[model samples]
Target: IYHVNNWYGVGVGSVVFYNDAIDANTDRSLYRKDHVYTTADKIRAGVALNNEFKFGLITAMVDWGVYLYNPARHYYDNPEHPIYGLGRRPLFYKNDGAGSDEAFHYIRFGMKTRIWDNLYFSASAKTHLHICEYVEFGLGYQIPFLKKENRKHGEKIFHHRKNWWQE
Candidate 1:
């Protein structure tokens, strides 16, 4: 995920934009369709609100994203269209090139906790509208030296502060 805001704090509003796509997966039995009645391969544009909740050393997050372009919903324009086959079913078209849909709202909420100062664990769940989509869990490791040489500089700063207080 790409973060537009540089600040990371509680009650701070972060605005972000995302473009998501569903790839064709034959193993998953998911396909991209281009027909009168088809599924949308793309959500086009997404806007989300990201908020952080802190609990001691652990941090939790809640995010809601609204998809602005859903091509799934269609209305019947010609029920007797030639391409509809023998049944003469209705011919559906794209709702809009880019438009908002109520059903495309997505939500994600999760927590991050430090397992060993630099090591961490994270868990999150994602849903489409109100339906459960998937849940994810991950393990991460961070080296203090990698974060702007925290190991060396951090020690010197602490040492200076300690000596300054004694003096």
Candidate 2:
């Protein structure tokens, strides 16, 4: 009476890293110092897994992406100090620094359906439990190397199945 369904794939996607900033007035500087750090055009590649339940259209997926390279620019933070005074210290800019591995871990819970035999659409949301990063609305078309009729079919068909965990 237990049904478990799963799907896995490896693919590449676009990734963006939003770096935090810090602003403070130091004793040596009369004006407030401000710094902004960020990076773009980051590529992410990882395996994604989706699980489905029986008698429902809901599906849960988890994606893990590891950034191939660190941010192009480094990040720094200005910490106020009573003894040493305020100074800018390396923050997320360093590749080896804390939480600087350039990896993103997120999970999605949603459903998908085929618009046509070859066209499909999906909707999901990436979240870290408390906060939702972005709502993903994707439309994709499946192109087969061979003719549609000649294309091979897997033993396990997801779209037609009622329960994924069924044995």
Candidate 3:
């Protein structure tokens, strides 16, 4: 039995843009100012299981994720008078505050088998309900870093599992 959890937050500062100046006498003369902002959040939960079988190994896992995004909010500013120019004031803006909501799901299935004392092969299939989907396979050989005669069998496998730290 296994359990995993994760969370993330992202935000972008407001963006501003100014349009080129236009002749004050022309009816088409218009000054425009624009601003935009965006933000997002995500959470995930998952469980995994592994078991040894007579012919090989079997592993299965599933994860559910919730993602919320603001995508974008925009503001447009117009000048009260064409000659006065469009400043930061007189801007029309709208933001949903909480924005939009979205959900995602994922599943993974894999197996590994030892063909020989030092040789092994593995394969996995994975799918993301709303993102990416793919399948992958790999082969590997276990070479003892320390003298095999000096290490216990269980200790060797434990060392492999502890190879690196994941964030």
Candidate 4:
């Protein structure tokens, strides 16, 4: 991540494995597409871009991100195809290059808001081209694994009263 300023930053990354292992149902198998059911179920490397804006205790934050590749179980395209399991049908995840039906990439956008102190509530969506796969909600807690550095006291911005550290 490259911080554009005190409140903004940009990030890009390439990962050999980016599957949402956390989303997978441990009872199922990853090798079988029908068994695994997550928008990020693919086992391929991903290249992506993201940026964030933050201020103050960073409470109540809004965010957005762009991600390539779509996790396509293509269960809805045909009426005959059952929603669950491949049923002798081919798994649809790998991108088929540039084409309207199977587009190259998808977009991910979401927000995370602090509920109380270190606790947070998050909601996000995964859109494969124009198709929305799902909306996910989660709860998280920030563990202060590392002791915080002493913050510079009495910092003023735009002539406003000192803030962001007095808390």
Candidate 5:
């Protein structure tokens, strides 16, 4: 459970990329009768299935985790259709008061890799449990104190320093 607050706007969460399918989501029904569903018949009770193993592949390293403290909710126009009329759910930082257990427990899975020196390219899906809410892509720049000199295109020189840790 790593603490992170990325584009998801989460206050607290835990994430792990097992590098394979070994890591996945398993959430159970909230049972409160107030939850999100893909259908309206109430046939599909809930989507949050905890501790369940799911198989997946990687175009890049895979990440899976739970948003322990998520205030994000799914809004519906009605409750009598199989297709959730709503499109990709909208996310907002509503308030700082949603309970940890009562709030919607969202799941996030995605792929990310460093495209260049300190630039990262990432695309991930945000879901309640298994019900995917939306997918997001982002590029971030990381500030580095240790300036690693960019190598020349055709140079055979490789800088070998004794302990880069000590600057």
Candidate 6:
């Protein structure tokens, strides 16, 4: 049996400014710069499966993930202001917190094999199946609890235990 879970959030904001003073006949081009704020949120869930085969010599695993975004609940809507409008028009501001919502989906498949004594290898492939997503792949090898043969020194002790905390 296997299980997994995950969650995350992202957001950003900026300030707006006006350069020129406002007068009855001031030109609209007098404004030099305007600022805007933006933000987004994302949530995700994941599930995984693992199995042991060939008397614990080989292992296989697969994981799938789904992400969702609420556009109505999160979106950016700010209009630019002209410099000449300053003082003439009542500045409007609201604390909408953040805007915009983006989503992503992903999956991963992997396998591991132990060939010959003291040798093990593993590989995995991961990918995103949605727009504005990314993918990655990885491979690894290692030998654990290896001891020299016919050593005259004090007896070497080896202990192997599963790490349940990683689950």
Estimate every model's Cα lDDT from 0 to 1: 0.47, 0.41, 0.33, 0.47, 0.36, 0.32
RMSD in angstroms, all models? 10.5, 9.1, 16.0, 9.2, 14.8, 16.9
Give per-model TM-scores: 0.43, 0.45, 0.31, 0.45, 0.33, 0.26
- Position 126, candidate 1: lDDT: 70
lDDT of each residue in 59-95, candidate 4, tens digit only:
2232233333334334223434354334333433443
Candidate 2: lDDT over CA atoms? 0.41
Q: Which residue pairs clash within candidate 2?
A: 3-165, 3-166, 4-164, 4-165, 5-164, 75-93
Clash pairs, candidate 5, are 1-14, 2-14, 26-49, 26-50, 27-48, 27-49, 27-50, 28-48, 28-49, 28-50
Q: Report the lDDT tens digits of candidate 3 across residue range 1-167.
A: 11121111122222122222122232331212232221221112333223232221322323232212211111222344343234432122221122121112234545666565457677766544333335667787867555645554333432233332220
Candidate 1: which pairs clash?
none
Clashes of each: 0, 6, 0, 0, 10, 4
Tens-digit lDDT track for model 1 on 1-167? Answer: 22223224433233332223333332222222323332443433556677666565566878876655444222222334455432332222222122222244567889987666457788988765554556779898754433324333223212213333233
**What is the C-alpha lDDT profile of model 6 across 70-123, one tens digit per residue?**
221112222443421232322222322221212233355566555433455666
**By the TM-score metric, which is better: model 3 or model 5?**
5
Question: Tens-digit lDDT track for model 5 on 56-126?
Answer: 21123233343332222332322433443233322322222432222234555667655554566778776
For residue 129, model 3's alpha carbon misses the true position, in angstroms, by 4.1
lDDT by residue (1-167, candidate 2, tens digit) is 11233444334455544422221332323223453322342222333444544333333444443333433222222244332234432222232333322223446566666655456677877653445646778897766445534433432334454433243
Which clashing pairs does model 6 show? 16-35, 74-100, 75-99, 75-100
Model 6 misplaced regions, further than 4 Å = 1-56, 66-103, 115-119, 130-167
